[model samples]
Target: MAASVQGGRIGNLPAEANAFVGRQLELAEIAGLLGTERLVTLTGPGGVGKSRLALRAAHAAKAGLPGGAWLVELSELRDPDLLTNTVAQATRLTEQTLQPLLQAVCEHLAGAPVLLVLDTCEHVLDECARVVQELLANVPELRVLATSRQPLGVPGEHLLTVAPLPLGERDDAVSLFTARAAAAVPSFALTDANRADVAAVCARLDGIPLALELAAVRLRGFPLHRLLEGLDSRFDLLVSPARPRLARHQTLRTAIGWSHELCTPLERLLWARLSVFAGGWDVEAAEFVCHGGPLDAEEILALLASLTEKSIVTRDGDGAAVRYRMLDTVRSFGAEWLAGLGEVEAVRRRHRDYFRWIARQGEAEWLGPGQRMWAERLTAERANLRLAIEECLAAPEPETALELTGSLWFFWFACGFTEEGRGYLERALRRAPDGSGPEHTLAVWAHRLVTVVPEDLDAAESVSAAYVWLADERQLPVPALPLTGASLAVRGESARSAVLYGRVGQAPAADGGAEFFQLLTLALQAYLLASQAAFERCAAVAERLRTECAKRGELWMRGWGDFFVSLAGIGLGHSDEALLSAREALTAKWRVHDRLGAAAVADLLVAAQAARGEEELAARLLGISRRLWHAAGLPQLGRPDRTVFHREYERRLRASLGDARFAEVVREGWELGPDAAIALALGGVSDVSGP
Candidate 1:
């Protein structure tokens, strides 16, 4: 985990750096470091936010330091000799009695704990160093926090590197940008839909706080792609606007420009070339994508490592492989210049190929015994997947979009992304070539069925018919028509469904990669058949379907199959057996928030209680079920499922007591059917079922 930023107390930070994200660890580390070491220096490249960090730490420790604190902006100081004087002025040092100011300021500290924030000292490093060295020597109670591009090269200095924020950190750079963008456009929200571009921006800027803030601010006037294009040539593009900055902040562009001028031409070129990839690009990817006759893979990797140390390329510590990302603002600026000189298309294509290959590697891993491991691996590469989809579908390329959507389907639905999947699948079908459309449509509707099954039968039919028509038109070898037939059968189109399945026969034995639609079809058929009173056939089909989904590691579908098993347990009058399955159904319905499933399972619970002659328990459940039924929008009718519940409850209530005193209570209302049922339930009247 990274450090969290404490909001700054002393003023003058750039507006963008105000919302710090993904720095929880850094904040805690600095706070602790400041407590232990009075002289903690924050070091990083120019424009990498060292000053912002020092201010943040100082503000966080404001309460910790009772004597309060002072910010001495040293970036404005030109002469190395003036460092101590700036600190003296901020502390209200006297010109008359002060013994050479630095020593006088140290005495002014006077035993109270005080934190002195010194920002941007690289240009006047020697002077700033001399001041801090003497201050710590003379004043034991005064703490000094200095920010610079590099270390002060002084002894007793605890150097802390201030790195970039993470895109996944909702409190980080991407989130900051997205929030600012939303403020500009009310409809804008950081959805999985737009997280790719936002993360791309964060990644390109190496997640540097200042760059993300500017990119986010630019959302006010510039379209993302246009800004991205301009950012490509950042050296020429982000020109400090040649305008004055807020009184406190130097132009972030100017700060960055200084660093660019300091880098070797090769390093600068490599920096620009890296913008083509989205999210974080691994070193291997950088070498291969930005590879040229000048910089071989190994040499490019070495140069990138150097840039990492320079804080231009930020690293993500996820164990095994540490990934690197460039901040969006910086990458965009660099990419703009690189594109002007002409390298965008070649580099972007290489970036595309790298992730496309990665997607294939995920696919290969899914076929092995490590099913859970592969699922987690895909989950981790969510950013890379977004980049792949963006690189392919921003212009709606059929082949790449279709294949890319297919690879990520598992991760999407598993992670509660139904609405997002619908959007991309819609795009894929509209643009994908003739061959890719049908299979992808099948995959898309399969997920929809999982969410909308049994309730949205009408919509399910339309989606199912699309798949059927697509398959028939293509003359493709049909793999699992039974699944579709079974679904159609569930909605009472049994004749047509049976005919369709008879043509294709049952699906082959469910294997690791067999379409999930196949098992779901069998499971639904088993459930429907069991409900229609075919106990023997239902049991056989349900057992087979459960085995199939389980083998494929389809926990959700396996749970669905278990629902059918409970029906058999109910049909046989095995109360204990049914109770176990009923509890599982209870778990499943609640886990997925399936209200209808929950209501239906309540019927099973009431049945078990009635069978055991637990009148009091059954009566209490009956009352609850009545409310659940009305909530389910069920129709009121005699013999309506709920009426059956009332009759059973009253009959049990009377039988358990066999008391005449209660007979008058039931005689007025609440009984076997609606008029009689409601009457018997509410103590209005008695029915034949009532005592």
Candidate 2:
């Protein structure tokens, strides 16, 4: 097992979803290759069990590697440029510097022995090749286990060809078949009477693992002879002479096509429509997006169940609400069929509409008792939401993109995907109609708010002008009011921020009427009051908001409320109270992966410590705050109002501790691992100097 390092655990491999049949030889060969080579590529066709085998190897070898084994699934990744960020996210390596992401990966794994399993790399061969090659050349101790349709072609890469199971005597294929069969039908077995027929069936299907699994699913409905007859007819129609490799690829394709042919028309339609989802979908989303044309909401569940039974779609989660997803190969086939049928536009529009409603609902209920649930749901639906956004942008009407993106203002901000949210807003803005409408104004305001990282002041100013032009001509809605106020507050216009926040009270305050809008407006109001050094008023407003948010189980806004309270406490000579408030908020922010919010809270804790004459610890935390600020891409506040306390604290710490000692202390903090840093901020420990 990987040796444990304090604060950083090594492994996060998911448990195998199904029984492991017979891959002892393949697993042993992979282990041997990993021991000798720095990069091992498992090359095979889709559904040929490359992912499964690679995952098995990773788990088997996890004990020896010290830094740990991690898996990054690249099948659903659409953008090649996000490859590094995606890997960093999978490995839980939060960036601590503005260096090139490749350099960041190298720095992270420079001295540690780690195994990185890059699954499904064929779709992104070029990008993956470049990243893997760079890391291999830079980090000597890093090993890569990649599963692709072909090799990544990097130097020092050992290719392992993963073939299908032996047909007749090895029992690998039949063992796989019988195992899956028993699940589909409890009475299923390779009895003496049926053993020959089952062997013949596996032989006819070429011993391919996925083909056998699908064939096994047929046992639920048909006897061995009937199932063999169906496969015979399907293969007779679809197959032709080819090379050994291409033939295996064709076999799996034929199997999926045969599965599609056996589905009911309603089931087939649901398959194609469900292809619109990028990830898994619950019945509610399937019904909402797939209903209305030859399919009723009531019929979707049954059809979905039928598809799951046929192994055309896989079911996940055994609760009352089961989620379903098609394999990538199957989804591709369905997408092709969906395009041929020309219902793509209608289906995609329905998908966009459903997700748009979800986003709007999230915005409405974000400050209530269901706040955390809404956050969790939005996170789960992110991939599907991306597909919806893609459809909106690609549709004839681009205004749908603008409106949908506009509805996600609070969701994006609360979830800390400000960078990605801005990219969507900018892309949608480029395609939006050049008019001053509700969506246009809303998109403009969202863009302005996202561009407020201090360095984007020029772009922020330009977008702000467009929003002001729209708001001047027409009254802005309650949700858009917070954007306007937050923009002013961050840009040092405290008076205008206060005025804009005051206008929110004039709007409707009903549960359905911009609840998050009202909630964030109050938080921003408290923030602005603190910005102006009105400590008493800031504490009063923040305390009230904190109590309300606590009642509703909202964390993001509540975290910011604690942040305001901490700031007020610091200004009011209450360092202990400030530290308590700061630590409480840090816990919440960390739970939500809100890096930007965590950075802000870290700074508050640092200041609170400085106020209490804890110079050494304060200096160390100050350095950590600097690292987090850079990681979050937020510029240092240059104005005296924001910088004076931080500057004075650093001055006092340096003067007391001496420059060299203070520099050593800050460097020690700079080397602090993520877990230790977070633990220090949360008061899990009083000191973070030890390993």
Per-residue lDDT tens digits of candidate 2, residues 315-433? 77777446788655567678877999898888888888899999888877777667656666677788988988888888777778888887788766766667888889889999975
Tell me the lDDT of candidate 1: 0.60
| lDDT, candidate 1, 448-556, per-residue tens | 4433333344455445555455445445444433445555555555566656556332444443444544665676567556535566677678778767766665444
- lDDT score for residue 50 of model 1: 76
> Which 10 successive residues of model 2 have the least lDDT summed?
238-247
The most accurate candidate by lDDT is 2
Candidate number with greatest TM-score: 2
**TM-score: model 1 vs. ground truth:** 0.55
Candidate 2 residue 328 Cα shift, in angstroms, is 3.8
